[model samples]
Target chain A: MTENGFDTSCGASSGTRILVIEDEDTITEFLKTGLKYEGYQVTIAKDGVTGVDCAREMEPDLIILDIMLPDKDGFEVCRRIRRRDSDVPILMLTAKKEISDKVKGLDVGADDYLTKPFSFEELLARIRALLRRSGRAVDSTELRVVDIVLNTETREVYKGGKKVSLTPTEFSLLELFMRHPRRVFTRETLLNRIWGYDYAGDTNIVDVHISHLRDKIGDKPPCLIRTHYGVGYAFYPGEGK
Target chain B: MWKKLSLRTRLTILYAGLLALLLTILGVTFFIDTRNLLIENTASHIRATAKPIIEHWLYGENLSSQAIEGTKKKPDSKYLKKISRQLARDLTSRNVVAIVLDKNGKVIANGKVLEEEPAPVSPNPFYYRRAFSGENEVTYILSTDNKNVLVLLIPLRSAPGSDHVLGVVQLSSPLTPVERILYRHGLTLAVGTLITLILGTALGLLLISSALSELRHMIATCQSITEGRMDQRVHLPQRSDEVGQLAQAFNRMVERLEASFSAQRRFVASAAHELRTPLTALRGSLEVLMRGAQDDPATVAHLCHGMYREVLRLSKLCEELLDLAKLEISENVQKEKVVLKEFVNEFEEQARVLSQEREISILEGPSVSLKADPNMLKQILFDLLQNALQHTGRNGRIALGWKLGDNGVDIWVEDNGHGILAEDLPHIFEPFYQGKKVSECGEHHKGSGLGLTLVKAMVEAHGGSIEVRSEVNRGTTFLIKLPFE
Candidate 1:
């Protein structure tokens, strides 16, 4: 096994190799068609044991593991893989939407989980985000929209080349808005992205932190983060007057 | 058979029947005694007047002419005759017969015989023979014609010097007058008894019908309330009685039931609201990842991490919800003798395996024994351990230990991690409550805030209690108490 496990570090050159460990032939075929259409080398495994063996031998770039398998469960397979490797980035496919199942997957070292009947667009975006985080893909590392620049690596921000002081929380909030420029994000979405999964607290915490971030970023003619009425905040520099 | 009749009807019938029976006995006894007394008095008066007249005739025989002249001139015969007529009238009035018979059984005179057949001989005919033997006798009978009669026979004797025997002077009077009066009395008694029975029956029916109508109304009202229209109330008549009190009690019960139902509904809605927010984010994130992972391996890796974190949050929320449901239902937790020491060791081993990537070590203490539901205990420990692992930074050590407590057993999960703030400690077991320090953790490590809540619920389900002692930025210890066998 490679350093990141399953040889997922080849970036876009080695034709994104994906291992589909699914019990259902129809879902496996469907996934194969979609991945193949996007220039991926797709391999299918009918059960957990084969999936694990195939993963070890082939060292695929990614593993799409179904939670229900004939010989072994997805949780056990994920734990077995994590026992020898740390950074393989395993994506779990589960038919159950129960929170206990999701927790089990993560607790066993699976990188992520997806309930069944998912859209293709969502699967692709997640893959891009994972690849980007691992530094194995060519993507825009620094988020830049007009005069604003965000260094994801150093967790720093600059407006018009002037250093802006921000709390760790504020810096992350600014980066989230900059990553998806011109898209509206509600308070709940911002909380989830910055504060992690299911962090139940005062929702006004978002508003409070947003104001603090604005103060540190300094006053500009058109605000850096614009609030959409009764919705959420958005990042757009030039268009809004 | 008695159970079939209502208590009220049965009691009324018994009371009225006993009263009528007593009255009938009293009336019969009184009528008999009064008729006997009247007959005895009439016979004594006749004997007193006739005795003196016969005595004077027998002793003054030599001067009988002078005596007769004296009686005529002074008119004593008219007075005597008037007195005799009165004695005859008295016998007729009381429906009794007066007879005067001589020693030879000859009748001297009769009192208004009224052409009726001579009174039938008394069943005690010896009483008439005794009167002829010079002793007075009174006898009672029903004559051949069905008339009730009383007979008083008196013997008349001459003066000592006279040798000729005076013939028996017998007075026989019809007893129909007294019989007629008694018959009228009996008729009156029957009519009175019938009227009393009729009145009692009518009153009893009226009272029972009224009571039954009220009871039916109450039953109908109760049925309506049971059918889910709890707003309905029993309207008891304005009386200070048992039925009114029952209505009051029923109303109070309905009030309590309505309050509890409404409270339950509110709790469910609030719980839904708490769960919806996390689920939506998790769904949105996973959707983005599923679309196109093949084209870019780097993007696939990043999205996988995001989805993993979301799943963790969702699972935590779900566990909290399950625990809440169990608590609400008061599920009976199965109990067995558990080796506490061994159980803690197993839990620590599991925790160590999970946190292997994080550089955390879970330490255990010596074994202890306690009686509890093994499954519920494990769940409580699992939740506590997860909370510890999440809050603990890398290289932080968590310890699982237990000791024999006075009441039962105390299991502790102490972690050298960022503990809860004082303000947040009180609300740690409330669903969806996160502390102030949550902003410190990155998006992936932050929790769903339901872990401790689930732990508390699971512990309580096992008939145990849990307490947390923590110092912010230092460490926290969760103490669980379970009963010992």
Candidate 2:
């Protein structure tokens, strides 16, 4: 997004919850930062016991699991989680290239597996694919919220029967807000959703995207996205003139 | 050439050959003795049959002498012929032929043997002339009839115990009956010997093969083991022979080989697993940094720090792997005399420096002397203490001491902290296995996960054993036993 040539909204990627269960601190941190940058909500659990509990509580769209955990292994955790929720997609991370390990992980209800040292791009692609395939993401071809119509497939927007031009980032940001109308999208959420959330710098970039999106959609005078000052941003459908 | 053959083949041949030789000698001895006994029985029967005939011939000779010339018998063929015919008729029987020869070695009467049984040729003049000198002679001759003859020459007297001119009574037995009996007996002896040899050899081969079967099974087991089935065993039934002893030794050797092979396999697996973790981290960090994370100063710093930590962990793993390999190559340790009390006192001081806030003390125990490398012992104690420090809280107490046991001294480390879970207690000593975290404050205390493994290897290298006992939420203790040297 924003000339990074990456779109966070494939269908609807914003606020897509993902849970990662891993014991390695560095790997877990790397996954958390990278997945967040790609605009997916990430929850981490350090051990299998906590991981199972979190999988039940988070009700995530996808689960990233590691096999080697301090208390219990990922297989045991996977089985326990699968017993409760059979629909959630589980992606396991393994350290061994042994076929038995991969087959066992799959046998225990893991949807897919990745070896360690995986590139973040591949991980993001896999997550997006899993989310789309699971039918968790909003997969409608077009969305209409208060006379603001967004075509997710053609990447076009129309306000009150008049087509409006928008950059890719502005288009993605609009698609996310329209997918879930009137839901609060924080600045961090906007930055994470639109600008790919790599830097923790000033979040004023989210404002710039919002203003640009508002301008392109013919909204003004405190309209479209309302600010929760000292917090983040949200889309308001009826309040926008 | 003999040595080139297999043991089974050589032993079979040797035992079979010995048995054959023994049976042949026995059969030959028995055959010869039986032939001699049969011949002697035939000769004695001829002598008994001739006894009454000789008496009858003497009575006829006395009557003839009384009727003609008044016992002045000399060179009278006609007078001797009638007496000879009478004597031949009485002595002739089955398998026995009688021939009466005059004093001049002429056969006077053949008892119809010449017509029916083909009598022996005329007696030898020198043999019968010697019989005329009152000597009874026995001889074997090949007669003209192509049969063997046993001849007993008896000189006829005018009366009992009288020295008078008479004729010679030759009691000749055709040895065809004895010869046929001997021939059949010889055939029996030969056939019996052959059968005995064949059966003995066969039985010997069977016995030898049965004895060697265990060895063959062991050989097959060896081949299977070479093919990577380390669990193959002979499993022979119990026996008290050499083969049984060898099987026992072979099974024991295989057990040791299997144990070592599995241990080696485990070591390689553990090394690969351990090395992969840090390497995975390093590669992941470098890859992240290379892919635009370097543009952010905070992310770059964080990734660089992580990479450094992983690099350090890799080097530590390398060092520990080297120690493990060295332990495998040379279990030979540099043993030195060490007094337990003094060693503990100095070691406790070093352990106290690892954590300044925790309570670590020593229990009073037996002051014993042992032969162990002090540096390795110190390293073992240091590793255990670090493990204890990582598991215990600030005010938790750890007691380290030694105690005299039945045959060895037991060194112990006990902590009054959160104990291990039952499931995890078994795998704590395994390399690269991380147990459940029990200490609230030990989160920052990092470990290589090879500490307990190294401690065990070092202790076992010194011919000692290490054992652990734990209960969840109560406490845990590690005991090491070093036998007195």
lDDT of 2 at B130: 79
In model 1, what is the error at residue A43, expressed in angstroms? 41
- lDDT per residue as tens, model 1, A30-134: 566555644568899977778888888887767788886755789988887777667777899876667999999989987788776565545756766765676
Question: Per-residue CA lDDT of candidate 2, range B105-176, in tens?
Answer: 777788655456546456777777778888754555545556677777777776667677588877776777
For model 1, residues B1-485, the per-residue Cα lDDT tens digits are: 97788866776677677767877787778778766655555556645655555454333333354455545322133233323433433434233344444344533334545654444243244665665465545434436555545455544434343333343334444556656766787788778877876787678767766766677787898789779887787777686677667777877887888777765665564466445444534454443334223234665565455556556756766766776776668776778888866776677677777876554444444566766788878888777878888877777777777776777777788888878889988878876565645633432354555667667777877777889999887889999886675
Considering just the first chain, candidate 2 attains a TM-score of: 0.60
Query: What is candidate 1's TM-score against the reference?
Result: 0.37
User: Which one is best on TM-score?
Assistant: 2
lDDT of 1 at B321: 73
lDDT score of residue A221 within candidate 1: 48
Give, for candidate 2 chain B, the lowest lDDT window spanning 10 residues.
B68-77
- For model 1 the local lDDT of residue B50 reads 52
Report the lDDT tens digits of candidate 2 across residue range A140-190: 566766667777778888888999999998898887776555556667556
Name the top DockQ candidate.
2
